[model samples]
Every structure is written in C-alpha cells, then in structure tokens.
Target: MPRKDTCKRRRIVLYAVRSAEFTTSDDRQTVYIVETDHDTYLFILFTSEVERNLYLYAREEEVSDEVKENFTNLANELSFDPEAITYLPKVPVPRRLPCLAPCDCPGDAPRVPSPPRRARPPDGLPRRPYGARSAQRQGLLFRQLFEAESFTYTYLLADPKTKEAVLIDPVLETAQRDTTLVKQLGLNLLYAVNTHCHTDHITGTGLLKQLLPGCRSVISRDSGASADILIREGHALKFGAFALEARSTPGHTDGCRTYVLNDQSMAFTGDALLIRGCGRTDFQQGSPEALYRSVREKIFTLPGDCLIYLAHDYTGQTISTMEEERTLNPRLTLPLEAFVELMNNSNLPKPKQIDFAVPANLKCGVQDVAV
Candidate 1:
C-alpha cells in the first residue's frame, strides 16, 4: 500500500468513555481518542503554538455549528498532545485454535465408574462452586469446588471445547478431598502444574497423577526439576477450555513461572508477583535484579486493571489489582538500585523446611510426609 493510503487510515479511537484505543508499535503504547466516525483527524497539541495551528487549520473550511462548537471545546480542554496516524493498521488476529478435552465417559464402556463425589451438607448455606473455562469458548464455564487445605488455594482452568482442566500448586495432605472435588465437579484431570516445585505445596498434584490416569505433571524449565512436560519461558499449553501463556520469573526460584489466563486482566503469579511484594528472592537461584525486571517488564507493563492472584498468602488475603501493586508495593515503589540493596540487606527468615519438603514435592503427591 502507498504511504499516502496507509497514512489515510486515520486511526481514530471512537469514544473516550467506557472505551479506549492505545496504538502500540515498537513496544511503546500511546493513548488517544477518536471522536468521530468520519475521516477528519486531530492530534492533541500540548503547546499553545501547535494548538493555535490545529484550530486555524481544522476550521479552515466552513464548519457546521455543532462541529465548530466541539472543536472549540475540545481544543481548549486538550492538555496532552496525541499523535495522529491515518489508516491505523489492523491488529494481528490469532489463528485457528484447538479444542479443550472433556471428561465424557466412553459410550461403549461398561458401568462408567461413578467417580468419587463430594457430598454437600443439606444445611442452608450457599454452595459456591468455583468455575473455570477455556478461552476457546466464550460463555462456557466449568464449575468445581475444593477446600484449600492449610494455606493452599485451588485454581481451575481449561481449554475451550475439550472442557479439560488442570490444578496448579495444590496441597498434598488433602489428596482425597481434592480428588473428590474433581470427581464431583465432573472434570477430567488432564495435567497438573507445579509452577515451581515447592514442598509445602504440590503434594496433592503428584498424588493425583497416579490416582487419576493420564494426568501428566508439568514444571518450569529453569527450575532444574523434572516433569512429564518440561515447560519454559516460551511454552504454552491449550487445555480443553483455556490456554495459558507461561512467564519465567526468576526471583522466587530459578524456575518460578507466572501464567496469564484468558487475557481477562487476571494472572496466576505462582509466587513471583504477590499483592504486597514479589516472592522472596533469598531462595535457590533467586535474584532481586531478575525479579525486578520480571514485575516491571512482564507483569506491571500490562493494563493497570489486570487482576493478580498469588498462590500462597498465609495472611488470608485472596486477591489484588495490578494498579495497587504498582503504587504501593514496598519493593516495587523503591528504585531498582535500592531494591537490589534491600534484597541483599533484608533479614527475612528461611522457608520452614525446604530441604526435607522440596525433594518430596518433586515426586508429585504420593510420597509420604517427613516428620
């Protein structure tokens, strides 16, 4: 296409309220407003000189009374200069996506093993079933419920049609409870992910793979740990209902990973980005500088409205917004130079029994607990 035609595209972000279009190129995002559907274009002018020039030229021809009034009001109120481009290029679209796996019993199979079921109390309590669905399907949601044992939190995510789901970083001590939860929910156990193999967590995931057939185990590449599926910074998986994009965050562990779910302003920051600060950097292969870049570049750069759910928060806080973390986190608020100093200086205690706990975590959940 000719430069003139490409320039003619006149990228306009239609409305300022309830919607916004930020044209991004070369890793830089610019926020702008498009007031009209027609081809008329205007760039925000910060300086008085540019403002006058825009006003004079925009009203060069005989303009309608309403348009003239709008031009005057907008021009006067405009404070920041926004770049104008004609014929903004269309965003690249994702290609044909595959389906999610479901837990449908085979038709010819004899008495479908009535999987273990969770019995809810008849008492008048609202049964809240946590639902997860694959990005492939927009409206379909798979619902499940499991009591988070000790400090563990249960998460359900699946591909669109396969309706398959995976449990991430669950507690081991309560294996039967979670299995019952999965069976009651009618979800097939495809794979379980231990974001970073940690002992206090992941015991159940290992146990489930054996108790439930075909459920593979996955972990990060840098983690230096083994798994059925070894994923790294660039790996992605399509579960039956949802697809997850893996992000390598080194501070928590050399292999600590974060998963962005459904682009719905929600990311499962295994332990990298927590509500207050990121995971502690004193652990194996943990580096403060690497953690800083992970949060600043990979996590914080996203929309402020995105939701971040941390895996372990002994304090009982469930969730937090990216905006809050950006503004208030002590580690994030400080300069990177200062952060590195703190990561080195802070006198935080070591995780309670990692040496004994971690070796067992690598086993997926069947191994017995150490005294």
Candidate 2:
C-alpha cells in the first residue's frame, strides 16, 4: 500500500488572521490557520518586541508532518517570522461547558449512553471497488478503470450492438488488465487513444497493439508522439456507428485534446479540465493563459448536461458534467486573471515517475526492459 500522504492529494487552504481569540482566554493573538476539506488547524505565534516563536495546533484531526512542513514554508513566504516555528504535540481535546438542564437528573446523568458502533465487514471480505460506472446511456458500453499508482483513469467505450471499441488514456501498468477485460467482454478493440503526451505515466497503446494485433494507436498529430494514426483537430475517431470528435483543447500541454462523443453526450477531458480543479501548469510545456482560453471556448461550449470524463483524479471523484465544472470548478470558474494567478501560484511537486514515464510514453509505452 502507498503511504497515507502519497495516496491522498494535498489541498491546503491557508487563512491569516490578524487577531483571533483563544477559547481559554479573551486575549487576541495573530494566528494563521490551515484548512483542508477534512480538517482545520491553528498556527499560534508568540511574539515579543525582538523575537517570535510559532506553534501549530490542530482543531480537528491530526495534521500530518508533510502538511506541517508545507504550511511552515507557506508561512515563511507570507513574511511570518519562522525562527522558532515548531509543530507542537497533539493537544488534549478541550471539554465543552456542561449543559444546564432542570428536568434531566443531576446535570451529568452518565452523559446519555452513546450509541453502539456498527460492526465492520470481516477481514477476508473484499472492500467495495472503485471505477464502477455510475450511469450509462442506452446502447453504450462503458467502463472506467483506475490505476492507483499514478492516480490515472483509463476509459473503455464500445457500441453494444457492434462490439467495436475505443480506449482512452490507458496506463502502461494496467495494459494487460484492460486488454483482458476487452477480450472477456468479446469486444473488438479498434483503437487505443491518448489525449496528450502525458508526463506522469506511459500510455498502454503499444502494449495493447502487441496483445491485440488489430488495435491501432491514436494520438493528436501535434502531440509529437509516435502513433499508428496521428489525428488533427475535427477528426472523428469512429468505431461501429458511434464516433468521438477530437476538439483541440491544448493548455495543460500543447497537444491536449478533448474528445466529445458525436452525439454530444459526453467528453473525455484530459488534463485540461478536471473535476473542480485542473492540471498543474508549471511544467511539461504548460500555459495557464492558454488553458484558460481552451477551457472557456472549447469545453465550456459543450452542452450543459454533457458528461465530462477525466484522465486522472486523486480525490476519489469519478466524473462530473460540463455545467457542474463551469459553475463549480474552483480554478476554471474564476475570472481569467484569478484563474491564471491560481495556476501560477500552485507550488506543486513534479510527478515522481516523470523521468521514466515521459520517454516511455513518447514511444507509446514501449520500454527497453520489463519491470
């Protein structure tokens, strides 16, 4: 299993409080709090005329060392004196004031016995799986596969009547599993397509071709990656009676494309537009401005109800819709200037596998040696 920190995506929201009152006292102090979707924290600073000391306290769950380090760095950038910034040990949970009740016997009455906890599943029992399709339209065969190591999602789409299929953003590590599923479903795998030249994981196109002799590799002509078929903007990748219209939605990378189903039912947005977020634009030929324009003009132009599939999601989200993203995506929903600032200010670390993934992906997942 991956480390807890690595498995979860990092989302830190920092708030600087000019003055905050502590529960124990009415004294106002300069405090900075770091919050995430799950937890809240307080950064307490002790300042004198000439020196300052900083301490961190969690208001809810325990904060990870990685989070502390990140917030500490952020604090320094915000001009906070960090000469003695330290993460204090977990503090005791503060007790609430006793409830006053005249009817209830003796103010404490054993605190009204807590409810019994539900029994958990047996150890041998398998946990619920991920990637199950939440909904499917008539005559469409769709499956979503997740690769945990890279947090990448690969999609398989086929026509129920003809069994002709196309796969999108398949990862090298999950190639065999994907092909096996295709075979088991008795589908005719026609094309292995990539939305862009990914920097985090190698594409499974080459491997799929080697396994399914008739399968062809597809990618954008401008992606600069070798493939059996190099498609340009407006090209239709058809299988059976259905087709996907390749719309040039470059920004996260120069070659990024959003493939919309011919009927406008759905779109597979690569790293260009994610669920409530977007791909980082610090590397791999990324451009914040270009991404903003691409999303606004190309993707946002799709039908409001059109389902939007993503290439990767680290926050356990499976899918979203065009309308949802247009209105709720924190990054894309912002004004152009604010969006650019958000992207530019994102201090994200480079993908750990970028060095090996990029070269192998450039060759469509044909590696020199086996793992």
Candidate 3:
C-alpha cells in the first residue's frame, strides 16, 4: 500500500472517451482484472486514434479466478510489462445508508430501528470508529501546535464545558502563539506540561506560567528539572472532569513519561515513540533496552484505538494510533535484540541546540543571571 500522504492525493479520473461502453463480457477489447490480498483492480486498455489510455477500477477484497485469467491473457497479448501494472491507492468512501421505506402501519406495528450515527468533534473533524467501538464522545477539544525550528508538536487539550485546558510539550519560542490561542478560545489554562526535559528546544512552561498566572508548570519528578509540580508514576493530573494518568516510560530519557487520558482514548508519548520510528537512544541517558520495554509495557498495552500523540514528528505526521504503531512502527515492532542493535548503530548527529537548551530546560526554561 502507498503511504498515507501519497494515498490522500489518489483520485480516479476518466479522460475524454467521447463514447465508451463496458466491453468486458463482449471480450472484444483489452480488459484485465488483477487480484491481491486486500483488493481487486480492473484495468482497461483503451486504444484511440491518437493515444492509448489505461482505465483502472478498484474494489475491496477478492476477485474471481476467471477475471484474473482474462487480465493475464490481455497483458500477454499486448506484451505489457507485468511490473507496469500497479494497484490503485486506497481511498476512503462514504458509507451508504440502507434505503428506508415510509411506514404505513398501525401504531402497534413493529418498527425497524435505524443504525446509530457516529459522533463527530465539534469542529466537524473525522473520528475513527471501528467495529463495536463508537466514535469519540463530544466535549473534547484538540488542537496541534508546531514549533518549526525544533519540529516539535505542542498539543492543547481542553474540556469545552468546563473551559479547562492543558498544553503539552510546549516550546519556549511558541509560548506567545500558544497563549494567544488559549486566550482566543476563552480557555482557562490549568497546566503547561512537559513529557520530558527536551534537548532540542527550551520548555515554554516558565513563559506560559508568567503569561497565564493560573497555570502551573509540570514535569516528571525524575526529570531533574524545576517545575511547579513534579509528577511520578500513577499520578493523575486533573482539570475539570478530565484526568491524565502519568505512566513512567523512560527510554530516550530517564524521566520520559507517557500521559494517558482517563478514558484511555489517547496518549502523549514524548520522544519515546514516533510515527514509523522512535527517538535515538544514544544520548541523554538513553537506553534502547529500557525504551523498548517502556513502549511494549506502557504504551503498546493501551487499547488499539487509543491515539498516540508525539512530541516531534519530522515527517509532518500529527497523530497515530496504538494499533498503527504496533504494526507499522519499524523501531518498536522489531525484536528486542534487533531494536537494540539498530539503536546503538544509528550514529545520528547530536542536536544542534542541546548545549543551550538542556541547561535552560534544567532550570525550567530560565536563563542564569549574569554574575
């Protein structure tokens, strides 16, 4: 399958075929059907006076053997390269509701109930509802903020009803932008939290506390960083009716923590895990073995549907799910021995801002006074 970003741009378009008709059953034209484990594709080679166009049709699941044979024969006849045919990218199609007929029965007549509609976020964003699980309930407001220099992601989660909010992994450079959004949303900033002491950028917790007087700075007790509140494993940060349980998940750093929502709906996984990859465990008290265990025991143990929000995503990925990371993340999905070897041999360059950022972050983003 193509990458998500690539698939997002996949669209089927039919070129100018002034007058065209389905010639599959007639066997008078070149038509082929290819089958794969997850999907079936139908390819039609249309010959025109000026050019030849390939029209492809994609369907979910298996296709008949006869259709496969037909496609193979057509390909052989045209001397087409087998490698030239490719599966069309998967696209999300809207679910079609069953047809409903007007009821003309007595009041006591039995009626068929309609299927439950999926709930959506207030901003009309799509929600994932698989199998028996229902969509995410309303009242949760989520926004993703970015710091370009560090490629860090700062998340703002709020309980709209209570106007209580929290900012996660905020960078100092983006403090004003984050505060502006908080004020614009009329939200009461309750906490400016860090998943860990970051080496790539200074924490915005101090600046945010200065700007939002009611907000407190928070970090893990083991982080060796000054904060208004130092949390440990099993500690719950509560605001309004929501609570985030802090789960010790040190690997990239000794104090790395994964904050999980009370509902187990999502988790903030700092640098412990990333989209398709993970953080380098070569410095900053980094340990590949410990990180591997942390991911498997702390993060991977969550429900498959639980969203995994990362502190930094170099590939522009905003969020992923436990299920996706479990099956798709190359680093986390590897065997323990393989993962350790990979991490040790990564040989990545050190962060450019580590020298300055680490010291400032140790003091909660405060610079030392001149002697």
Q: Model 3: per-residue lDDT, tens digit, 8-88?
A: 121112122211112211111233334456554545554321123344454323446666565556565453433344434
lDDT of each: 0.57, 0.70, 0.70
| lDDT minimum window of 10 residues, candidate 2 | 4-13
Which window of 10 residues has the lowest lDDT sum in candidate 3? 5-14
* Superposed Cα deviation of residue 43, candidate 2 (Å): 63
Stretches of candidate 2 off by over 4 Å are: 1-136, 365-371
Per-residue lDDT tens digits of candidate 2, residues 1-371? 21111101111111222122211111113344455566555555543211234666542236666776777696665345444456555443212211111123222111211112234446775221112332243357889889998899999999878999999999888989998999999999999999999988888888888888798888888777778888899999898767899999888988898999775657999999999988788887889999999999999976555678999998899888776798888888888999888889989888888897777777763433343
User: Which clashing pairs does model 2 show?
Assistant: none
TM-score attained by model 2: 0.63
Off by over 4 Å in 3: 1-136, 365-371
Clashes of 3: 1
Error of 3 at 92 (Å): 41
**Which model, 2 or 3, shows the larger TM-score?**
3
Instruction: Encode model 1's per-residue lDDT on 3-22: one tens digit a residue.
Output: 21111132322232312222
